[model samples]
Target chain A: MANDPISQFQIKNIVPIEIGGLDLSFTNSSLFMVATAAAAAGFLFLTTANRGLVPSRLQSISEMSYEFVASMLRDGAGSQGMRFFPMVFSLFMFILVANLFGMFPYFFTVTSHIIVTFALAMLVIGTVVVYGFWKHGLHFLNLFVPSGVPGLLMPLVVMIEVISFLSRPISLSVRLFANMLAGHITLKVFAGFVVSLGGMGALGIGGAILPLFMTVALTALEFLVAFLQAYVFAVLTCMYLNDALHPGH
Target chain B: MFVVTPAYAESNPTEGTHSEAGAPGGDAHGGGAFPPFDQSTFASQLLWLAITFGLFYLLMSRVIVPRIGGILEHRRDRIAQDLDEANRLKEEADNAIAAYEQELAEARKKASAIAETAREKAKAAADAERSTSEAELAAKMADAEKSISAIKAKALGDVDAIAEDTASDLVKHLLGGSLTKAEVAAAIRAASGK
Candidate 1:
């Protein structure tokens, strides 16, 4: 019972609330989300509060993250995409901080859930669609029609393009969701192995060493995935935003 | 950290039992769906995610992004200004060096000119002094020659008179005869002439 891996992902209510028959109770998920936002915002605000010409250690970190996202956007979306800098930066920092927060034991991984990731993905895709239409009107549909497709296969190619385009949100959301979920489950399972095996005698303790090592290794890998997923998410967001900015190609 | 997970699990034994027992026919959260896929908590999770993410975006757009961006922009401007100042100072220094070199060259030229004029003046003065001394020496030599000629002439005149008196005395002593002064004079004159 104490070794149930799935229990960690349970959304236990912290402050149960009933409003209009909707279950908007603040759960552990919400707590971690709030924590992630606070950590990200608070760190940036505090570190750059002084706004030194030469940044301090903490300040350097803040500046590095800023430059990192800025350059990522500039590269992925070009100069025109700079208008979306705030959104892209916000997404990047939120995911990065949330994923790091999830790395802690007993902490809820906000990104581990599909609905949350889907919402975030939809936010990006929605921005792209709205902004694309608003900025370029129906011309944004040119994205589905490749410029060099032959006349006969044009419809077939566009159909493929449309299907692929629709899959962007799903892939974006699922990639992060699946990675976080799978990594955490794997880590938990191996950790469970260590516990179950160690419960036996000295022979079992010796046998548990392998899973213990694996668990340790997996934890390190999970940390990498945490940071990597955040980066991939931000990069993909930039690319999608790029599509919105220049939908023709 | 590992210890914390088990302790956490122990504290939430209900959730653990619920998942294990109700894997087939899970209840609200655990009966049918995985915890992440559980539709029951979707609204709440979405609400909080929206709330926190929206606030985060606002903070970033309103305060944080601008602040960091301003810092970067300010640093870039400062560096550019510093580089400009450095270039200006270097140009000024180069100009100063050029001016100093030109002044040094001019001073050297002026000094040589002064030295050349001084040398010419010294040489001219020496030549003038030499010519004046030579003129004085020539005048002195001419005067000495004039005086020597006069002395010679006077001695010659006295010698003539003495020679005549001596000749008369010799004739008187030799012949015991007195000759007249005019005759003696004539005789001496004739002798001189002969």
Candidate 2:
């Protein structure tokens, strides 16, 4: 179908999916989310199943992934923050795998949706808040109150801090969603050019070849961006956690 | 541009059917259709978060951390063992040096004692030789004195004998031949200095 590319993002109602008249559509987005989770679990399981002194290929990859995340957490958050390594590592792998999976022809880009990205961002921010409170109690609020500030500027500083705090989720979610959506849109636009021009005469077809090359180039660049975005998300999460742990510093 | 028109036509059919069947609200199939916020999605997200957190925590705590810790502990043990061995070697070297010093002192003492003993023996031997030489010289002087006295006695005796013989010969001559031996001796005594 000509519309299949756009329709890939559509929500299809499945058996009403209701416990008590709640219209919960098991949409294409939901299906992709489940697929992403299953794939993540299977990949980790397969890679880590055979633990050996000398590593196989899969084991090497798993070990490398482990070291990568550990180093990142240690570098960004220090030894005291090492306890958060697992959460940050999982978040990175999950998002990276999901983004890569979405690049396939039949797959849906779950990160392109605002709700999914927002949910992930909220979780990271919420963890920072909750962990801060749990660890430091009411003293965590000292993060807003800058030390050595003049009494007159205290209130202004606190207001700025609160505004910055509230904007965290928006920035986090928007960064991921915007990147995913823009990359997909650009890819689609380029692909459309190639397909349309290729159907014309030889001169038009010749013109289409350039777009095809550009699409390939852009796709490769998108892959790199996908990996970088995951890394950025995980590193930022660690930094936020660090802030929560050591507030005023 | 030609591809865009065809894509719009294909998407429009689905939009028409969706609007006709659904409630009279905002367009569900519009270009900017955003799903309404549902609180239930939070529960799903939370569930996923919990599952992932638990699984990852278990992997890190039970599997990864322990392995790394074991490696570190083993390295520490090896280093400690090497240090202990080095210390032992150092102690052994110290002991050997101490032993060598002790033996050297003992040899010096023994050497000095032997030299002193040898010096005493040499002095005694020299003293004994000197005493023996002095005794031999005294005996030789005594023997020479005895020989000189004997020679002096013997010469005196010989001188007395010769004087007697000469006096007898002079008396015989003074007696005028062989008259009477008694008368001749008397005459010689009278003439000699009476």
Best by TM-score: 1
Across A1-249, the per-residue lDDT of candidate 2 in tens digits comes to: 442345555444443343333334455565666677667666666666554545678766766776787788888888888877767776787788778987898677777766677878888899889999999999999988889989999899999989998899989888987888778778877888888888888988999999899999999999998888888888888888888888885
Residue-by-residue lDDT tens digits, candidate 1, B44-120: 88899999999999999999999999999999999999999999999999999999999999999999999999999
* Candidate no. 2 TM-score: 0.65
Q: Determine which window of 10 residues in candidate 2 chain A has minimal summed lDDT.
A: A14-23
**Whole-model lDDT, candidate 1?**
0.89
**Each candidate: what lDDT?**
0.89, 0.71
TM-score of predicted structure 1: 0.86
The backbone clash count of each candidate, in order, is 3, 0
Q: How much is the lDDT of residue B114 in candidate 1? A: 100
Per-residue alpha-carbon lDDT of candidate 2 for residues B1-194, written as tens digits (9 for 90 to 100): 56666775676666555433332333433532322232333333344444554565465556654554444455568789999999999999999999999999999999999999999999999999999998998899899989998999999777655555666676568864553555544655565536
Q: Which runs of model 1 end up more than 4 angstroms from their true locations?
A: B1-32, B148-194
Count of clashes in candidate 2: 0
Assess each model's interface with DockQ, reporting 2 decimals per model. Answer: 0.40, 0.08
